[model samples]
Target: MSPLALGALYGIVTIIVMCSGMPIAFALGVVATSFMYFFMPASSLDTITQNVYEEIASVTLLSIPLFILKGAAIGRSPAGRDLYSAIHAWLSKVPGGLGIANVFACALFAAMAGSSPATCSAIGSAGIPEMRRRGYSPGFAAGIIAAGGTLGILLPPSITMILYAVASEQSLGRLFLAGVGPGVLLVILFAGYAVYRARKEYRLAHEIYSQGGIKSAYLDDEHFTFAQKVEMLPRVLPFLILLIGVMIALYGGFATPSETAGLGALLAIVLIAVVYRMWRPRDLMPFLNSTIKESCMLLLIIGMSLLYSYVMSYLHISQSAAQWVVALHLSKWLLLAVILLMVIVLGFFLPPVSIILMTAPIILPPLREAGFDLIWFGVVMTVVMEMGLIHPPVGLNLFVIKNIAPDIPLSDVIKGTLPFLLLMFLAIILLCLFPGIVTGLPDLLMGAR
Candidate 1:
């Protein structure tokens, strides 16, 4: 069979296997191994062993587990509650303060956690109940936490970015740097919308009560005294130190990504055990076990995807597909739009890691041939994947928020995310219009390489 025919067959088999509930790593490995056994030359089989060795031996890839460990340590610590309290106190005077605070908290936690579900669970567990008690709509409260949690992937120290960097053979530090501007843009958009929605809804509720002459008991914000605010600083300072330390270490050329991640994990463990005094053998064991479990899952997927990638390369399928795409001579922006739309659709079904691993090998060649910057594209792709976390059927953050706030109907949570979802698209538009949003910082800090 022709390579293109074989590639199409492999693609169909993959989709079927995944839809049939096979784990992604297993699905990829099964399909690739099957293809290799039946069609490819037996001599070409050695590539699988080489691919596994290369992927496992990667120093850059080491950052993934370290970052995961760092995130797990912080997520398992008291940092989430403290960070939320401090941020809530500071932002209490603002309209939609709780919701806005949730956004800020998620962004901060994302810097440490590097995973959306972790961010959602950590902040949502605290923010949702408070918002609900404060007379905020359940849907609105759930939406804020769910949408905000996506920052975990777009922000620095992102696991998705690490995977992309390794898959695309781009600089890990530069990709991390590139994410800053887009991440900030998304945060501002989400926070601004939260404030607007909060103020508008609050006004409507008040007017309704006044017109009906009904007595309403709304939860009032705590007015922390200046001294009280000062006291909250201790709860937050350690997190700030970790965040700043990791950023400086990565961007200042002081350490490689892996080294910085190790440092962050170490600091997180120390803070949890010593400063917070929340560490116990029971708590510590679970946290360590969870990190190991998650790290193994991710690493296994990476290894399997490497095997699949080897298959694609051996068949020359990726290059042929790239040439086929280029032959159409589609306008670059048009092609980019199509590619991103496909990514967004895939997000509804696949996790970000699977999406990046499965698609990057096929798409990156075409994207690079069309003169797109891989680092910038990585940021853009990360932003698009952020949408998937809140999208339906398989939107992981939606389920996460639902799990945290079970009383909030799934539909309401989905409704609350709609506005933020639109804002994500707007952010994407702006990024495309000004590629600098994704590239500016990286170029300045890393000098265009």
Candidate 2:
């Protein structure tokens, strides 16, 4: 059979198995193993064990567990609440300060946790009720954090970025740097919209108060003395320093990704212990359990994914697909739009990790041939993934916020998150118009891939 036919069959069979309610890991594993047994020689079959071992044994991959542990350590502790509280204290004077604080807290936590659901659940649990109490609309309250939760993948130490780095064989450090600019851009846009919406909401409340509404027109009138704000810092400052210091050390070439993740993870544990007083085994078990569970699942997927990719290589499917795409002679920009659209559609069904693992083998080689910078494309891909976490069918953040604010309808959660989703698209546009936004930090500090 032609390589194209083989590739099509592989995809068809895999999709059929997955559609039959088989787990994704099993589907990918079964398909790859079946192909190896049937299409490849018996000698090739013997290497499957070695390949799976070698795939998981990667040094670059060690950071996955460490990062997961660090995120879990903080996510399970009071660190997120502290972080949000301190930020809210500082920003209280601004319109939509509560919402904006949630965005910043999400961005910072995203840097620490590198997982979207964890970020959403941690911050949403604290921020939603607080916003609702302050008279912010339910949809607005839930939407902002749901949108902000996406930062977990766009910010540095993002597991998604790490996975892309491994799949595309790009630098993890460089991809981390690449995400910073776009991540900050999205934060700024989310905050800006929050302020605008807050002002409008305040105006509406004031008009209602003129007719003797139950409450005053003011939106909580929260205030904090500088000294009080400073007081809120002690519980929060160490983690801030840990975040900054980790980036500096990683980008400054002081450590590799694994070492940086290890140091950051250790500091995260210590800070949470000292700050949250979580030294007891009961306190510590939450982060540990989460770390082991998520880490093992990711490693399993990685091993299976590597095997899946190996099958493509063995069949020359990837090579043929790359050549066929190049032969299309399409504009690079158009090709990018098409690829991103495909990613967005996939997001409607599969989670980000699955989308990346399943498509990277096929999508990446073509992008490389089109003269696109794989690192820049990686950032773009992350932003697209962020969009996936907030929408329907598989929008994890939507459900997360809804769970936090059970009184709020899921439709309200979806409607509230829609604006931030658009802001994500705007961020993507900015990156496309000026690709430098994605590459500048990495190119400047890491000397460009």
Candidate 3:
């Protein structure tokens, strides 16, 4: 069969298998292996094994598990609650104070936990109940957490960024640094929208209470004594310290990403034991198990997806597709728009890492040839993928919110994320128009590595 035909067949079969409820790792592995066996040389089979091994053996990949461990350690502890409490105390007077606090808290927690689901679970578990108790609409509360959780991937120490670096052969540190400008931009947008929505919602809530002849204490400001605000600091000090320490280690030339991740995980454990007093061996078991399970699952997906990318390379599919795309003589901006739109469509079904691994090798070559920087493209891809987390059909963050707040209608959670989803798109557009937003930090700090 022609390479084009083979590539087409591969895409169709893989999507079919994925839609059949098979795990993405297994689906990709099965389809890739089948194609390799039938169309490629026997030696290519050997190459697949070696490729999977080498991908798994990557030292950079070590950071993923360690970072996940750090996230799991904090997730299993009181850190989430404390972080939310501290931020909520400070921001409560702002419009939509509780919701706005959730956005800031998610951003801070994303610094420690690189996984969106973990960020969602950590903050949602604490923020949802409080927001609902304070009379925030269920959909609004769940939607904020779901959308805010996406910051975990766009912020520093992101596992998705690490995977992109590995797959694209980009600098891990540079990509991490590249994420900062866009990450901060998205946070501001989300938080600003949260405040606006909260202000409007608060007013409506008060009106409803007044009509019912009930005093609405929920809209009242939480007046914290200066001393009370000071007391809230200790609850969040450990997380702040970890966040600052990891950022210093990463951007200050103090440690590699892997080493920094190890440090963060160790500090998390110590905090759980010493500060939270959850040091018992039994208390630690769940964190360990959760970390191991999640780490293994991600690694397996990485390994299998690498195998899939290899198959595309062996068949010369990626190069052919790139050549075909370049041959279309499309304007650079138009081509980029098409590629990003394809990514958004894919996001409805695939997770971020899968989207990056499966598409980067194919789309990136054409992008580079079109004069786009891979580092900037990486950040753009991340922002696009962030939309997938809250999008329908398979938006992982939506499902996560559902699982956490089972009582909240899934439709409401999905509805709530619509505005934040548009905010993500705005961030993407800003990045496109000003590539400096994505590349400035990396160039300044990492020197265009």
TM-score of each: 0.97, 0.96, 0.97
Model 3, span 211-265: residue lDDT tens:
9856565666668677777898986887798889889888898998899999999
Instruction: Give the runs in model 3 whose Cα sits over 4 Å from its true position.
Output: 209-217
Question: C-alpha displacement of 356 in model 1, angstroms?
Answer: 1.1
lDDT of 3: 0.89
What digit string (tens of lDDT, one per residue) describes model 2 on residues 1-449?
Answer: 99989999998888788788877777789999999988889898889889989987989889999999999998998889989999999999877787789999999999988889899899889998888888889899999899999999989889988888888898888889889999889999999999999888888898888778867424457779999999999998899999999989998999999999999999999998888788999989878998999898888888888889889988998788878877888899989998999999889877777788778888998898788999999999999999999999879899888777799999889999899888999899999999999999888986755
Q: What ranking of all candidate models by lDDT puts the best one first? A: 3, 2, 1
- Between prediction 2 and prediction 3, the one with superior TM-score is 3
| Cα lDDT computed for each candidate against the true fold | 0.87, 0.88, 0.89
Stretches of candidate 2 exceeding 4 Å from the true structure = 216-218
Candidate 1 per-residue C-alpha lDDT over 1-449 given as tens digits, one digit per residue, 9 for 90 to 100 = 77778788888988898899988899999888888888889876767777777876788888889988999988977789889988998888877787789999999999888889999999989999988878788898998999989999989899899889888999888899899999999889999998898888778778878788554434344587878778999878978888999899889999999999999999899888877785778878878999999999999988998888778878877777777888889899999998999999999888998889888877898889899999889988988999999989899999999898888899999999999999999999999899998989989988965
Q: Cα lDDT for residue 82, model 3?
A: 89
Cα lDDT for residue 269, candidate 2: 92
The per-prediction CA RMSD against the true structure, in angstroms, equals: 1.5, 1.6, 1.5
Report the C-alpha displacement of residue 419, candidate 3, in angstroms: 0.7
Per-candidate clashes come to 0, 0, 0
